[model samples]
Target: MVHAFDFTAPDSYILNCSTLLTELPVLERAQAAKDAGFDQVEFWWPFDGNPTPTSAEVDEFITSLENAGVELKGLNFWAGNMAGGDRGMVSVIGAEDDFAANVAIVVEIGRRTGCRAFNALYGLRTEGQDPSGQDSTAAANLDLAARAVAEIDGTVLVEPVSGAEGYPLKRYADAAEVVAKVRSEGPANIAVLADFFHMSVNGDDVAAVIEVEAANFGHIQIADAEGRGAPGTGSLPLRDWIDRAYALGYTGQVALEYKQDRATAFDWLSHVTQTA
Candidate 1:
């Protein structure tokens, strides 16, 4: 089996500790990533309210990275809350002002950290406080998003969630359409972060999307259909994802993001194999 892309072991994977708020003291997590042979790592908006970490904190984090020999791929500020906002709080796309503020912060964080991308949310609406209006807001937000994407030294990706795990996330919205909008108005830096779990939830054929929407994919994160865990632990065919990624010309990081009691990248090793 000739693999499409060759990713590194101990290379960067998005370290999603957003759920584990108590554990987000970045130095400890980054050091763990370094020890696991990971070349790089990411935080989901490590700081709130602003994009760049304070000069002192950024310097300290960078020093930690240097000491650990860890590189940074990028960061994710999934809408306003960065990662998952506890107790059902999330960003509403129609709340245009808040949306802009959050993404701007995401951009700033990426710029200062030497990170590569920002991830924001178009959250879910259940009983209709204008779920349908999100795209419009997302579109309206794009002009500003364009400004951010164009000037942003890094890239920005629109991440729509599957409404699982108690998070208020938008479901089955047109990610392709939104991304196309981003690309048109601004720098090509804006793209999509394809989460395989969301694919499974929405019955999206991820491999097929990869074939056609390959160029749109800026990042790829994975877990199985049952309980977001390492690839191959559930229904997602790990081998197929690799094959399709290769077939589709995607040679980017396939970050492993799953929930386990302890923070450990090694847990994904047996469940995933990157064959050359």
Candidate 2:
């Protein structure tokens, strides 16, 4: 309940620079958020193609946030070929080494920018690989990520990605189970990245999810169910759900992960940020 009133205001949450300013250059999106009146930002892995990016690239990425005068709030550990159809690789049969390689890099980024939550997307099912095998791989990789993130006083996030065919963790229980399994193996900082839009699309009672799983959520993201637009553009009672989440004991950054068409005018932010 630390940020309970934040449900009524914009400053309390971080803008998802990656998703918000997709039309802008990746390195320049942080500045875009800052220019748009946001003081904090989050992103998917900045490097889409390179998991083990060069140190120079890492420095530039960190510098982007620093230069933009925005605090880095959350980041995803690389999920493979996001544009080429891969949702993630941590749970894939032969991608363990690649996933492992990105752990330190992600942790190092977190250390540099003081970001504390790192999302680990569960990969899609293989054509012939057994379900159990993918599950096992996901658990092990999540455990590994938990250990690394814990070193920096960070949390490893498991998210339920929606509209993703064949991907695991499509439900709140699915992601929660992964977090529980990781915790059972003894890592305490592993938690779910509760994304209301995805949960809504998957036909869950999102408010009930907050009521039941609030304590286990490390972060939250929001977008309307209809067309995944800004809050008022669709039917979601966003303010109510946000308030519900705060009341239920979820104290974490609420990221704006909604999509935009060519024109990215975020007028809703001003309305939300206002106080009487």
Candidate 3:
């Protein structure tokens, strides 16, 4: 019941600025999150259409973060056509080169900003490709990312996503196994991204997963299960569950990656400020 955590804790709660500021352009999300009273922000690939954006675009992105005065806590490598239903591209057979191309840019963004956490979405199953082959591709790409980010002492996050995207990494163990596989091949920077909303949607024992996977967890994301909305807008006991994660040794940022009307998204900001 006592979910009181230090608000000043390093990487306390990160606002997934991309999810929160849906109405705004990618460049404006950071400012929106800052206006909402969040000091740290994370995002999916800012350029959803381009795996390798131009140098000017990358500089603009860095400047946005700088001007918004928000620390970039997390960033996802280029997940192919995420808005078009592709959960990830790292495992796609033909996407290996593109995924590789995006690595240096992702690392540079992290390097220029102080972001140390990166999320890699395991690509969805292709109709004709064998599952085993796809798994191999994912492992290889994840390994590459792990090695690159390790230069900056960064962590690579693997998360289980939900919905009808037919994504192979839909369970906590599924993601953990991939993280382990990547770590086996490279540095130990690979870890599971424990998004309770996805676990709950997949019917995993959330509490048990937290207890067992806390040590391997690199980052945490949250949303209420009923509609993938803000913490107070759904059925999940987010306050208690998040406290449990912190108690069990999860020191990373608890990213608010959810869907809600931006106009009222900060309604629970006061509660988070008080309780977290």
Candidate 4:
């Protein structure tokens, strides 16, 4: 049952509570993650559709992490109503102000939590709006985000998501392209978020991407392809991909963002952590 990678390292992986622990309330997920043996956790926008949540809400969030003794390693900027079909506000034409507002909040959160990585999901293509315009808006917002986070020594991440129709960034290269564009414009802190499940589902050569773009990765997330479950639940070389990324000099935490029962979602880690 020995695995090639060491899953016992304290900083090696981050449990993505946003996707994994669905049964628990948002505030409780941090403690749940800690109880599950993770010292770090990442989350999507916790505020329900509100770009600017009250200070009390923010305080509660930080307190939860503190109470659980789990570090907030990564977080998403307010991507508009994810459950209602809005993927992100970054590229939405009229949502520029909201995105800018969210950036400030995210920066403050990063300052308080020592979290340096922030994922900015690119919004889906609008029905009649010009794609070029949306791209421009996205670039502008990304630049703004990068600059805002830079004050906290933070990084802005662009990720390719799957199962999200109209989501423009579906492949590693697609997200990388956006990253390249934003980075070129003077925000050096921007990078691509390599989500293996999304890339694999979108038909990207995940291994090749790791080999070539490891240096450009700000963070790495994984879930088995086809089912978006735990490491061993679907067909993906999760261990090899992770080992390869580490060998290629990528040192960021690997986020486990998958949908599965809490009881068995992390069962694979038990085997991986076992010594021969």
Candidate 5:
């Protein structure tokens, strides 16, 4: 049960249930995380991409965390149809209402779970749509979400994603630019989500980003570069990158958002500690 990294506190790292432990039902992943020695967990839009889920569904989602004795540290606002290739609607032309409606739900979740970090993914570019208009829409939606989450003392996150074509925000600078635009309008608590796997895949210098952009990062997620698997599965120097970020003063939980079977997903932890 030894962890890969010697985190100073139980809450230092979060197991992203949305990606890990896929063999079990979504609700059961929390308990699995707890059993595997994680005190906190995070998720993508969990209700089948439904923005306005039923009251019972919300209750059940909350109950799962409570029963597992794990904190819901991070959550994603509804992005449209992830399986169908929709990254998010914050910037999409026709999905403004859906994005707006999801903001309230996200706030409620934050209020109830003390989850303070919310990631809002920017949607893909629509055919025949102006990029400028999409950027404006993204900024506005992010502002609204930032304001709503701020009521709960939460920060909204903009992440650069890879592997999805037409999706904007492919680099740390891209996301940071969007964050800067939103912040320019007014004071809203928003920051860039530094997912190392995505940034590296998109050809960003991960070490340089950690060195220069640490102050602008709200959260961090990690998976190896070539395959997006566990830390040691690919060529990424993930341990070094994480250490560098911490050395540069990043005070947030690092999320384990890699793809692997539950049985062997965490094997890298021991491998890392042994090598270190």
Candidate 6:
């Protein structure tokens, strides 16, 4: 199998800016990455902070990409819909009127950028609800998500926040079940985003876990196990993921999405960038 290797970039993979679209202006950020020899990066909520940078901004962002020789890989949709939504992972189907209204804002962002991936939220659970009710409600919320993004032209990702309760998907299989069930319905737009740090926090078995959802797996976010910092900062057996990706015929972005406890995670990225 052919590995992505030099085929992928990581400069934009950082979540360094306190808020989306902040920090260096989009153009400057792209230029910096190009100067540093990176070909790929991502924008969190590119719509926030600034009035949607005009075509002028898109022009600049694109220009930076051309100059820096970088690719705008993907945009993670973080429109506050999931922020206070009970640690995330509910089905937005049952959200209060305000909740649905809130998510619409995120949907608008996806539409504007034509983003392919988005995180679905299901505000806090309904108090004093039963198991069957909860399951049905969750299912409804998943349906609502699929419907909301039906015209989004991209994929809507479902991620189970690490360290959360009941939704304990310490492994990919557990997570896959959630994805699979959601997709079992019509129009398979729902996919799973594997986050290594959270898996580590739950003491999950990555090898067996990832295989379960290998197919449904769309994007990946990883970092050292400690402090949610960049790789090389901790002792998480990360290479195993590379090995698994190759062996499983996986072809997706291994996004180095993590917090910048210091600068970016460019330390050992050179070798890995060429090999990615």
Q: What are the root-mean-square deviations of the candidates from the true structure over C-alphas?
A: 5.0, 2.8, 3.3, 3.6, 4.1, 5.6
Worst 10 residues of 4 by lDDT: 267-276
Ranking by TM-score: 2, 4, 5, 3, 1, 6
Put down candidate 5 lDDT per residue, 1-276, tens digits, no spaces: 222456433345798998998899998988888877788999999999898998899989999999989999999999989989889889987778988888998899899999999999899999988999998888888989998898999999999999988998899999999999999998569999999999999999999999998756899998986888988789998878887787777877699999998777777563222111
Give the per-residue lDDT of model 6 (tens digit) for 139-161.
Answer: 65666666777777666666545
Model 3 root-mean-square deviation: 3.3
TM-score for every candidate vs. truth?
0.76, 0.94, 0.93, 0.94, 0.93, 0.69
Residue pairs with backbone overlap in model 5:
4-269
Cα deviation in Å at residue 47, candidate 5?
A: 0.5
| lDDT string, candidate 4, 121-181, tens digits | 9999998889999999999999999999999999999999998889999998899899899
Candidate 5, residue 179: how far the Cα is off, in Å: 0.2
Residue 160, model 3: Cα distance from true site in angstroms: 0.6
lDDT of 1 at 260: 55
TM-score: model 3 vs. ground truth? 0.93
At residue 59, what lDDT does model 3 achieve? 98
**Which stretches of model 5 miss by more than 4 angstroms?**
1-11, 270-276
Residue 54 miss distance in model 6 (angstroms): 14
lDDT by residue (tens digit), candidate 2, 6-59: 553556778887678888888998877777667888988888757899999899
Q: Write the per-residue lDDT of candidate 3 for residues 1-276, one digit (tens) a residue.
A: 234675434245788977777888889888777766678989899886589999999999999999989999899999888778888888888889999999999999999998999999888899999889999998899999999999888988999999955798888998988888877766898889999999999988898887776756788898998899977788888777777777777777688889998766666655333211
**Candidate lDDT values, in order:** 0.58, 0.84, 0.84, 0.88, 0.87, 0.56
Q: Once model 4 is optimally superposed onto the true structure by TM-score, how far is the C-alpha of residue 33 displaced, in angstroms?
A: 0.8
Give lDDT tens digits, candidate 1, residues 69-137.
766676655344434443112325435655556666556555665677666554554345565565556
**Candidate 6 weakest lDDT stretch, 10 residues:** 14-23
